[model samples]
Target: MSTVKIEKGQAFWLADPQEHDFPAAYDYLELLFVPEECKAFVDKLRGATTIKKKSKDILRASALPLLPDTNCHVKENLRKIKKKEKLSPILLVRANGKLIIADGYHRLCASYYFTEDLDVPCRLV
Candidate 1:
Protein backbone atom coordinates (compact mmCIF):
# COMPACT_ATOMS: atom_id res chain seq x y z
CA MET A 1 0.00 0.00 0.00
CA SER A 2 1.24 3.46 -0.84
CA THR A 3 1.25 5.70 2.16
CA VAL A 4 0.11 9.27 1.74
CA LYS A 5 1.94 11.37 4.26
CA ILE A 6 0.77 14.60 5.82
CA GLU A 7 3.93 16.63 6.02
CA LYS A 8 5.31 17.98 9.25
CA GLY A 9 4.17 21.46 10.37
CA GLN A 10 1.05 21.08 8.22
CA ALA A 11 -2.50 21.21 9.49
CA PHE A 12 -5.66 19.79 8.05
CA TRP A 13 -7.26 23.01 6.86
CA LEU A 14 -11.03 23.17 6.95
CA ALA A 15 -13.01 26.08 5.63
CA ASP A 16 -15.98 27.79 7.20
CA PRO A 17 -18.51 25.99 5.03
CA GLN A 18 -20.65 28.32 2.95
CA GLU A 19 -23.19 25.61 2.39
CA HIS A 20 -23.43 22.58 4.57
CA ASP A 21 -23.60 19.20 2.88
CA PHE A 22 -26.91 18.28 4.44
CA PRO A 23 -30.37 19.78 3.98
CA ALA A 24 -31.19 19.16 7.64
CA ALA A 25 -27.87 20.60 8.75
CA TYR A 26 -29.48 23.09 11.10
CA ASP A 27 -31.91 20.62 12.54
CA TYR A 28 -29.44 19.88 15.32
CA LEU A 29 -27.22 22.87 15.83
CA GLU A 30 -26.13 21.99 19.33
CA LEU A 31 -24.91 18.56 18.32
CA LEU A 32 -22.85 19.90 15.42
CA PHE A 33 -20.57 22.13 17.49
CA VAL A 34 -19.79 22.14 21.18
CA PRO A 35 -20.49 25.13 23.43
CA GLU A 36 -17.45 27.09 24.53
CA GLU A 37 -18.74 27.79 28.03
CA CYS A 38 -18.47 24.15 28.96
CA LYS A 39 -14.68 24.06 28.59
CA ALA A 40 -12.34 24.48 31.54
CA PHE A 41 -10.05 27.48 31.48
CA VAL A 42 -6.40 26.59 31.39
CA ASP A 43 -3.88 28.81 33.12
CA LYS A 44 -1.34 28.19 30.41
CA LEU A 45 -1.77 26.78 26.95
CA ARG A 46 1.12 25.40 24.94
CA GLY A 47 2.22 26.81 21.63
CA ALA A 48 2.24 25.05 18.26
CA THR A 49 4.90 22.50 17.61
CA THR A 50 7.72 23.52 15.37
CA ILE A 51 8.60 21.07 12.65
CA LYS A 52 12.17 19.84 12.48
CA LYS A 53 11.98 17.02 9.98
CA LYS A 54 9.89 15.55 7.18
CA SER A 55 8.11 13.15 9.48
CA LYS A 56 4.40 13.50 9.98
CA ASP A 57 3.07 14.22 13.44
CA ILE A 58 -0.54 14.17 14.39
CA LEU A 59 -1.59 17.26 16.33
CA ARG A 60 -3.49 15.11 18.76
CA ALA A 61 -0.12 13.78 19.90
CA SER A 62 0.35 17.04 21.71
CA ALA A 63 -1.79 18.53 24.45
CA LEU A 64 -3.60 21.36 22.70
CA PRO A 65 -5.73 24.15 24.12
CA LEU A 66 -9.25 24.74 22.95
CA LEU A 67 -10.66 28.20 22.39
CA PRO A 68 -14.34 28.54 23.08
CA ASP A 69 -16.71 28.45 20.12
CA THR A 70 -18.60 31.69 19.59
CA ASN A 71 -22.12 31.61 20.99
CA CYS A 72 -25.36 32.24 19.08
CA HIS A 73 -25.91 35.78 20.38
CA VAL A 74 -22.25 36.71 20.16
CA LYS A 75 -22.17 35.26 16.67
CA GLU A 76 -24.78 37.80 15.62
CA ASN A 77 -22.81 40.53 17.29
CA LEU A 78 -19.89 39.65 15.06
CA ARG A 79 -21.81 40.77 11.98
CA LYS A 80 -22.64 44.15 13.53
CA ILE A 81 -19.11 44.40 14.87
CA LYS A 82 -17.72 43.62 11.45
CA LYS A 83 -19.80 46.40 9.87
CA LYS A 84 -18.80 48.96 12.49
CA GLU A 85 -15.21 47.88 12.92
CA LYS A 86 -14.70 47.02 9.25
CA LEU A 87 -13.05 43.80 10.30
CA SER A 88 -11.56 41.50 7.72
CA PRO A 89 -12.10 37.79 7.45
CA ILE A 90 -11.54 35.81 10.62
CA LEU A 91 -7.90 35.05 11.24
CA LEU A 92 -6.87 31.72 12.57
CA VAL A 93 -3.39 31.80 14.07
CA ARG A 94 -0.84 29.19 13.09
CA ALA A 95 2.74 28.47 13.96
CA ASN A 96 3.63 29.98 10.61
CA GLY A 97 1.01 32.60 9.75
CA LYS A 98 -2.75 33.22 9.77
CA LEU A 99 -5.55 31.48 7.94
CA ILE A 100 -8.24 33.77 6.52
CA ILE A 101 -11.80 32.59 6.65
CA ALA A 102 -13.14 32.89 3.09
CA ASP A 103 -16.69 32.84 4.40
CA GLY A 104 -18.81 32.91 7.52
CA TYR A 105 -21.28 30.37 6.06
CA HIS A 106 -23.62 29.83 8.95
CA ARG A 107 -24.23 33.54 9.21
CA LEU A 108 -25.08 33.92 5.54
CA CYS A 109 -27.89 31.38 5.67
CA ALA A 110 -29.57 32.98 8.70
CA SER A 111 -29.03 29.77 10.61
CA TYR A 112 -27.83 32.25 13.19
CA TYR A 113 -27.59 35.98 12.81
CA PHE A 114 -24.44 37.86 13.71
CA THR A 115 -20.98 36.41 13.71
CA GLU A 116 -18.74 34.47 15.97
CA ASP A 117 -16.22 35.12 13.22
CA LEU A 118 -15.26 38.58 14.42
CA ASP A 119 -12.07 39.24 16.39
CA VAL A 120 -11.72 35.55 16.96
CA PRO A 121 -8.28 34.05 16.42
CA CYS A 122 -7.83 30.30 16.43
CA ARG A 123 -4.77 28.07 16.44
CA LEU A 124 -4.54 24.32 16.56
CA VAL A 125 -2.12 23.56 19.31
Candidate 2:
Protein backbone atom coordinates (compact mmCIF):
# COMPACT_ATOMS: atom_id res chain seq x y z
CA MET A 1 0.00 0.00 0.00
CA SER A 2 1.08 3.56 -0.64
CA THR A 3 2.29 5.50 2.36
CA VAL A 4 0.44 8.56 3.53
CA LYS A 5 2.10 11.90 4.22
CA ILE A 6 1.61 12.84 7.83
CA GLU A 7 1.69 16.44 8.90
CA LYS A 8 2.07 18.01 12.32
CA GLY A 9 2.43 14.67 14.15
CA GLN A 10 -0.85 13.31 12.85
CA ALA A 11 -1.02 9.59 12.19
CA PHE A 12 -2.46 8.30 8.92
CA TRP A 13 -4.94 5.45 8.54
CA LEU A 14 -6.42 3.37 5.74
CA ALA A 15 -9.93 4.36 4.70
CA ASP A 16 -11.10 0.85 5.62
CA PRO A 17 -9.55 -2.08 7.40
CA GLN A 18 -7.48 -4.65 5.59
CA GLU A 19 -9.07 -8.06 4.85
CA HIS A 20 -6.74 -9.91 7.23
CA ASP A 21 -7.81 -7.66 10.09
CA PHE A 22 -11.16 -9.47 10.36
CA PRO A 23 -9.68 -12.92 10.88
CA ALA A 24 -7.12 -11.51 13.30
CA ALA A 25 -9.93 -9.88 15.26
CA TYR A 26 -11.90 -13.12 15.24
CA ASP A 27 -8.92 -15.04 16.55
CA TYR A 28 -8.50 -12.65 19.47
CA LEU A 29 -12.20 -12.40 20.22
CA GLU A 30 -12.44 -16.17 20.39
CA LEU A 31 -10.44 -15.98 23.60
CA LEU A 32 -13.23 -14.02 25.28
CA PHE A 33 -16.29 -15.49 23.55
CA VAL A 34 -17.68 -18.69 22.12
CA PRO A 35 -16.99 -19.40 18.47
CA GLU A 36 -20.55 -18.43 17.55
CA GLU A 37 -20.32 -15.21 19.49
CA CYS A 38 -16.98 -14.45 17.93
CA LYS A 39 -18.40 -14.98 14.50
CA ALA A 40 -21.32 -12.67 15.22
CA PHE A 41 -19.04 -9.97 16.54
CA VAL A 42 -16.79 -10.19 13.51
CA ASP A 43 -19.77 -9.93 11.22
CA LYS A 44 -20.95 -6.84 13.02
CA LEU A 45 -17.50 -5.29 12.95
CA ARG A 46 -17.18 -5.98 9.24
CA GLY A 47 -20.28 -3.92 8.62
CA ALA A 48 -19.51 -1.22 11.14
CA THR A 49 -18.60 2.25 9.96
CA THR A 50 -15.33 3.82 11.02
CA ILE A 51 -15.41 6.26 13.91
CA LYS A 52 -12.84 8.49 15.60
CA LYS A 53 -12.01 8.50 19.32
CA LYS A 54 -9.17 9.75 21.43
CA SER A 55 -6.54 7.12 22.09
CA LYS A 56 -6.57 7.86 25.80
CA ASP A 57 -10.34 7.53 26.01
CA ILE A 58 -10.27 4.13 24.37
CA LEU A 59 -7.58 2.94 26.78
CA ARG A 60 -9.65 4.26 29.70
CA ALA A 61 -12.80 2.58 28.48
CA SER A 62 -11.08 -0.71 27.80
CA ALA A 63 -9.10 -0.61 31.04
CA LEU A 64 -6.11 -1.98 29.13
CA PRO A 65 -2.64 -0.89 30.05
CA LEU A 66 -0.62 1.10 27.57
CA LEU A 67 2.19 -1.07 26.35
CA PRO A 68 5.60 0.49 26.79
CA ASP A 69 7.70 1.80 23.89
CA THR A 70 10.00 -1.18 24.32
CA ASN A 71 7.31 -3.69 23.39
CA CYS A 72 8.11 -5.36 20.06
CA HIS A 73 4.69 -4.88 18.54
CA VAL A 74 4.45 -1.30 19.74
CA LYS A 75 7.91 -0.64 18.37
CA GLU A 76 6.90 -2.00 14.99
CA ASN A 77 3.87 0.25 14.92
CA LEU A 78 6.06 3.18 15.85
CA ARG A 79 8.34 2.32 12.97
CA LYS A 80 5.34 2.40 10.65
CA ILE A 81 4.50 5.84 11.90
CA LYS A 82 8.03 7.10 11.33
CA LYS A 83 7.88 5.65 7.83
CA LYS A 84 4.60 7.46 7.18
CA GLU A 85 2.83 4.19 6.43
CA LYS A 86 -0.89 4.13 6.86
CA LEU A 87 -2.21 2.03 9.70
CA SER A 88 -5.31 -0.15 9.65
CA PRO A 89 -8.28 1.00 11.64
CA ILE A 90 -8.63 -0.82 14.96
CA LEU A 91 -11.45 -3.32 15.60
CA LEU A 92 -13.38 -3.08 18.86
CA VAL A 93 -16.25 -4.75 20.71
CA ARG A 94 -18.25 -2.79 23.25
CA ALA A 95 -19.82 -5.05 25.85
CA ASN A 96 -20.71 -4.70 29.53
CA GLY A 97 -19.60 -1.06 29.52
CA LYS A 98 -16.09 -1.95 28.45
CA LEU A 99 -14.32 -1.83 25.11
CA ILE A 100 -12.56 -4.92 23.90
CA ILE A 101 -9.74 -4.36 21.48
CA ALA A 102 -10.19 -7.25 19.13
CA ASP A 103 -7.24 -6.04 17.05
CA GLY A 104 -4.75 -3.14 16.81
CA TYR A 105 -3.82 -2.79 20.45
CA HIS A 106 -0.21 -2.22 19.52
CA ARG A 107 -1.11 0.42 16.99
CA LEU A 108 -3.18 2.28 19.56
CA CYS A 109 -0.38 2.24 22.06
CA ALA A 110 2.08 3.44 19.44
CA SER A 111 -0.24 6.26 18.48
CA TYR A 112 -0.41 7.26 22.12
CA TYR A 113 3.29 7.96 21.90
CA PHE A 114 2.50 10.82 19.56
CA THR A 115 -0.28 12.22 21.75
CA GLU A 116 -2.85 10.81 24.14
CA ASP A 117 -5.39 13.10 22.48
CA LEU A 118 -4.67 11.59 19.07
CA ASP A 119 -7.83 10.67 17.20
CA VAL A 120 -7.83 7.02 16.23
CA PRO A 121 -10.05 5.52 13.58
CA CYS A 122 -11.77 2.30 14.56
CA ARG A 123 -14.64 -0.01 13.73
CA LEU A 124 -16.68 -0.71 16.86
CA VAL A 125 -19.42 -3.30 17.35
Considering summed lDDT, which 10 consecutive residues are worst modelled in model 1? Answer: 37-46
Candidate 2 lDDT tens digits, 46-115 = 9999999999999999999999888999888888988888899999999777799999999999888888
- The CA lDDT at 57 in model 2 is 95
Candidate 1 residue 75 C-alpha distance from true site, Å? 32
Off by over 4 Å in 2: 1-6, 9-11
lDDT against true structure, model 1: 0.25
- lDDT (10s digit) by residue, model 1, range 1-125: 11123334332223321123221222232243343311211101113222221111111222222212255643553444444432212211222242211222332222112221212222222
Summed backbone clashes in each candidate are: 6, 0
Q: Model 1: clashing residue pairs?
A: 75-114, 75-115, 75-116, 76-113, 76-114, 76-115
- Root-mean-square deviation of every model: 16.4, 4.3
Query: How many clashes (backbone atoms < 3 Å, residues ≥3 apart in a chain or on different chains) does model 2 have?
Result: 0
Q: Pick the candidate with the highest lDDT.
A: 2
Candidate 2 collision pairs: none
